[model samples]
Target: MSEPVVAVERLPHALDLPLPAYATAGAAGMDLLAAVSDGRPVTLRPGERTLVPTGIRLAIPDGFEGQVRPRSGLALRHGVTLLNAPGTIDSDYRGEVGVVLVNLGAAPFVVHRGMRIAQLVVAPVSRVRLVERPILPDETRRAEGGFGSTGTGVRSGTDNGGFPASEDREC
Candidate 1:
């Protein structure tokens, strides 16, 4: 299938920076760079959060949305990640794309201008209608089971706090 086209406009602050692009042929997301206006790095103290601007606007097509996701390298190495992971950019949004980054590590993290801080994934969105109903039909074997309803090899009778035990099978 042909790739969908997304229109991107660079603001004055990012005029010299390259547009978002995928790092590999099979990558699903395009890297989003930090566009700090002053050409200086921004430091994020531990337990702190800040909004970093991308200095660019996108014209996403109808029936699609932009998802801002965290870079795995940053999260694993520095405990830095998006405050609102998978932040959604609706098709009607017309303002600059900003990333809310949080530092969860013990040390401070620096964000330099044009640094690859996050990634943007354009995905198709499904519009669904909600219908009010008095009662819903039973769906499946796991219906209304809530969390930890499926066995995870945890002693079988103890509370798992809705989390799968270490011995849980990989999905």
Candidate 2:
């Protein structure tokens, strides 16, 4: 096997701390977050955004991909999550890593620079080739529909099948 070619950068302010890395072999991703106040976290106002730095950028090799995801701790505790959760950083992208976070909880959270905001998981990617087709597949019970299109029906063994059987049921 050949050595993986990945480029990394340490932010000027990241002198005291080391760049994020995984400890175990199964750890395909590393936590990329900042250390804010003991509890306060970063907050994003409605329709507003701030570039929350991850303090590093990677040059993922071809045939590979980088998935930027929200750190579980941040999400569960603060309701702060990546606006574009699992955002893809393609191999060709050469930009400083940033997680676009949004505050979905009722209260605002404070985000300090150098705080760990998200994580980056690197994985292998396979390219799919497309072939032109004159006609598309015609039909099926759930074609082109979503959310609850299959009759909004209940599960096979469920009593009501997810739909009200009568008008008096207050469906």
Candidate 3:
């Protein structure tokens, strides 16, 4: 199978940095780099958030969307992650890609130019034709139950808002 080609243009500040690319053959996302001016670094204290620029514009084909997601290693090690995780880039958007990063750890985090701060996953977009109806199909066994509708480890008989009153609470 062939990969979809996405057109990209690097802005002036990003000329020295490489374009987003997969680190391995089996990787599902392309690493997005931080394009701070002149390869400069930006520091973020704990609980601080900033918009880190990618300095690149993309031409995502119609029927596809770009997803900006946090790197697991950064989140697990430093508690740094994208604020609006899995931020969506619409197909029609032709502007610079900026990552909204937040430091959730006790110490400060530094973002340098060419640092892999996030990943971009291009996914197919399926458009649906909405048809509103007063009534829908028959109810399923777990209809309308959200959140912890499924039972937790402790199997108590009482319904914890999610479980039905008469239903069995067994896991």
Candidate 4:
């Protein structure tokens, strides 16, 4: 499939920082940088959350949306992660893209200028038209069952019609 063209606007403060880009040919996301205007680092205490600015805006296509995700390296090494992983950035939005990062580690993490804080993944979006109906248009064997309706581990019963049965109830 062909890639969509995303128009990115770099603000004055972010002129020195590199624009978001894919690290590899097969990468799905573009690294978003932290545009610290005054060149001062932002420190996040343990268990604290903050919105880090990117100083850039995007003009996403009408049928697409930008998904902000956390960096796996940061999460595994420093416990820093985006509060709302896969945060949605609608196409209509024209403001600077900011990431809500939280520190889940025992020590504080410092966010510096041009640091790769998060990633932006542009994806296609589908708009559904909802119609009121008394019943769904489909049916399934596990209708209305949720949570741990499936067995915790290996099971030994036929009450579920070959499907895993809940702890005390048959499928």
Largest lDDT belongs to which candidate? Answer: 1
Superposed model 1: Cα runs more than 4 Å off = 152-171
In candidate 2, stretches whose alpha carbon ends up further than 4 angstroms from where it belongs are 1-5, 23-25, 35-48, 137-142, 150-171
Cα error, residue 32 of model 2, in Å, equals: 0.6
Q: What is the Cα-based TM-score of model 3?
A: 0.84
Candidate 1 structure quality by residue, lDDT tens digits, 53-112: 999999999999999999999999999999999899999999999999999999999999
TM-score comparison, 2 vs 4, better candidate:
4
lDDT of each: 0.89, 0.70, 0.88, 0.88
Error in Å for residue 131 of model 1: 0.7
Clash pairs, model 4 backbone? none
Q: In model 3, how large is the Cα lDDT of residue 161?
A: 37
- Kindly list the per-residue Cα lDDT of model 4 for residues 22-139, writing each as its tens digit: 9999999999999975658999999999999998999999999999999999999999999999899999999999999999999999999999999999999998765544344456
Q: Is candidate 3 or candidate 4 better by TM-score?
A: 3
> What is the C-alpha lDDT profile of model 3 across 1-171, one tens digit per residue?
677789999999889999999999999999999999764699999999999999899999998999999999999999999999999999999999999999999999999888999999999999876653333345555655557865544333323435334433233
Error (Å) of candidate 2 at residue 119 is 1.0
Per-residue lDDT of 1-171 in model 2, one digit per residue for the tens? 876768887656455556878857887678786633334555676444566766566788999889989878777887788889888999999877777888776677678756667778888898876543333334445544566766875333323434444433211
lDDT of 4: 0.88
Model 2: which ten-residue window has the lowest total lDDT?
A: 162-171
Extract clashing residue pairs from model 3: none
